[model samples]
Target: MSRNHAVLTALAFLASVLLPAAASAKDSSYGFDTDRDRFGWAIMSGGNSTTSDVEDQEALDKLKEEYGGDDFLFLREGDDRYVIRDRALIERAQRAVKPVNEAGRELGEAVSEQVHLALGTSKDARERARLGRSIGRLSREIARAARRGDDTEDLERDRDKLQRQLDDMEESSRDQRVTVREKTKTKTRSEEASRHLKQATHHLQDTMHDILHDAKARHLAEPMR
Candidate 1:
């Protein structure tokens, strides 16, 4: 096959094997992000170290070792460093993640079931009010847990202050009464259920963040799109 055809085909296979949603998406930032992640670089972050001449090659080598590639695909740029172009692996090992993926799905489903059960059986307005606040706090925490990128000293301080404020709000909210209008809500969830849902969401995002991070994609690739 031609080089371009091979590249496309290889990428397609990898995307399908690694991230099912990516291979099927017509237009999705998630899919594109998945591609960028698989390459161990973000197309959004611009940096000289992220160039194919150095950064990408380092990522490629790690993948080669991880996937048991028989032949290397790179050109030497300097002493022991390479410019990676074609990431086509000659003899690639199949990634063994079916059992792990199935387990994750099963755990998610179990959590959903448990949360539904809790929501179904409980009807404490005070508890529901508390659950609402907990959910809101968890939503914010989920966002924080999923946040990426380097933080400046000022940003770190700001985040710490914001976290303190959130903690204060959560603590003070415990004493606040839910009005009649709030108690008459058609839908309400128990604290257990709310906590389960929010925790599960947070866990999922954390897992994704860890995956991209552990891929050694600490920087972006140059000529980012």
Candidate 2:
């Protein structure tokens, strides 16, 4: 096959194996600020040697031997040090984001299930109250998931239905107490908003692991030196 076709085929295979909902959605930017510094120069802080000191190929070879291979990218930092980033630290940092995504996803699923149960119950004032609470919670969860780049279409659809139902219930009910103690905010961040983080994080970790391993292996096999 042609190179472009082959590339497309490879991407198609990945899509087939990955979560369809997440793969089809637009890129998310929920934790960008938190992860912005996670992937730059890998280096041992304080103890790192300056790149200026490696004046020859022999010095560079020793540096390569110190790290894994010479194939990895090397760059000078503002401190004038030739940095070899702490891959282990970077890996851990990347892994740290996993829990956040998971929290978002699991929380979203839990809220969605709660909403489902509320909808199944009798449409009494109390039920309206329950659903009214669920609608707000679900909206936050859906928004969180959307922010994390997960497909919230299904959840959003359900939330919208709940809103419409709640509106109808409110209009017909003479009791204003149904919404008297409505508490939209929560102490927990995940509870407030974040449901899609799990799905996105899982896929991201998997993809990053595969790519990193593959590239490292490929380069190690053909060392730059």
Candidate 3:
């Protein structure tokens, strides 16, 4: 063969050998389907179904095997239609929980610190009463934060400690209030306010602990967790 014809022949032979291997690599990378349009359809359907009337169960199975079902928020039933219970609400809630939990933790820590400081510096009956009320308010905030459902065991433990501290403060405040009122000959009540406060705090703490434990258990049960 002439020089130019020999180069062309070699080029053709290289293409023949490389083309099939390249195609096979692409197939392995993206799976059996090589069409970009079909991949787009698969992704759009949330890997549930590929095309109209084409079950695409293979793709769905691959997705479930890889990413798990919970990671995907939508389920594909038909080609063009999907089932979403509350897309906007679910997305909003998912986005909101993280920030709310983080803010709650920071606020709880600050409140706990202030309560500790107040307990140490309180000298007189009035000072003790003021600190007690402040601690009580902080305890309520911690309880509310816990109800938001982002607490870990550590967070729950800290919250429980804060609640107990608040209960102690309230009891001290009630006794001081009674002493002050009796000394001045004013009408003093015999109601057990501290007991009620303690009960409320304990109830909220227990509820929060249960919620956190349940969440942890559910997380452990998830396939990809």
Q: Assess candidate 2 and give its lDDT.
A: 0.41
* TM-score against native, each model: 0.24, 0.33, 0.24
Ranking by lDDT: 2, 3, 1
Off by over 4 Å in 2: 1-94, 105-150, 176-192, 195-225
Overall lDDT per candidate, in order of appearance: 0.30, 0.41, 0.34
Which lDDT tens digits does candidate 2 get at residues 96-196? 44565455545544444333323322346456646645664555556444533457688878876876676566556664333423313221333344434
What's the residue-level lDDT of 120 in candidate 3? 29
| lDDT of candidate 3 over 20-127, digit per residue (tens) | 222332121112122322221122223232121124546545655765543332222223222222334324323433343333333434443333333322334334
Extract clashing residue pairs from model 3: none
Scored by TM-score, the top model is 2
Q: Cα deviation of 99 in candidate 1 (Å)?
A: 4.7
Q: Which stretches of candidate 1 lie above 4 Å from their native place? A: 1-94, 97-100, 125-225
RMSD of 2: 15.6
Candidate 3 regions with alpha-carbon error over 4 angstroms: 1-69, 72-93, 121-130, 133-225
